[model samples]
Target: MPESVGMILTLIMNIALFSTANYLAVKLSTRNVKRRIIAGVVFLLFTPVIFFSTLYLGFTWDDTGWGAGIMTVIYTGLYLLNGLILLLSAIHIYFKK
Candidate 1:
């Protein structure tokens, strides 16, 4: 199978895992805002970790220059986009008027 196929399958599998984990974590925790927030925060952290790990695996198997450039652009764009969104969210949450 192609690296892209592997990447797609990995991405799909991780999404399922994260979703189920989040559901179970929140469901099994004692009813409290802290537990839910902790689960959400952990889910947030896992997403990018899983994404980059699968991306790294794909990178290792891919060889084309065009694929490299496209992946670089995608990876950088996603990092910047996610960082900017998180920054904005944090500012809004912690600095609300």
Candidate 2:
């Protein structure tokens, strides 16, 4: 397999893994239809945001990629989203009982 192909595969895998995890976690954590929709929508929106904004290093092709941190904010955004979902889940559990 070509290095570029491998790199692309890895990138897609990253997006899929994170999005899928978040989708399931938030979807099952709450019964509210609105919250479920929001969780799905956020994953959809986040996919593109992380995809376009992150720089693909040459490591994709076994070469050195530009060590740019331009898309670092996406990481922060993901962390924030994660915390938001966890908090929302806790709130849902609290009010449900």
Query: What is the lDDT of every predicted structure here?
Result: 0.54, 0.57
- Model 2 TM-score, 2 decimals: 0.44
**Candidate 1: what lDDT?**
0.54
- For all predicted structures, in order, the TM-scores are 0.47, 0.44
lDDT of 2 by residue, 31-87 (tens): 665555565456555655555445454244445454223233454367457756565
Flag regions of model 2 displaced more than 4 Å: 31-62, 67-80, 88-97
User: Model 2's lDDT to the true fold?
Assistant: 0.57
Alpha-carbon shift of residue 42 in model 2 (angstroms):
18
Q: Which ten residues in a row are the worst by lDDT in model 1?
A: 79-88
Once superposed on the true structure, which residue ranges of model 1 sit more than 4 Å away at CA? 61-97
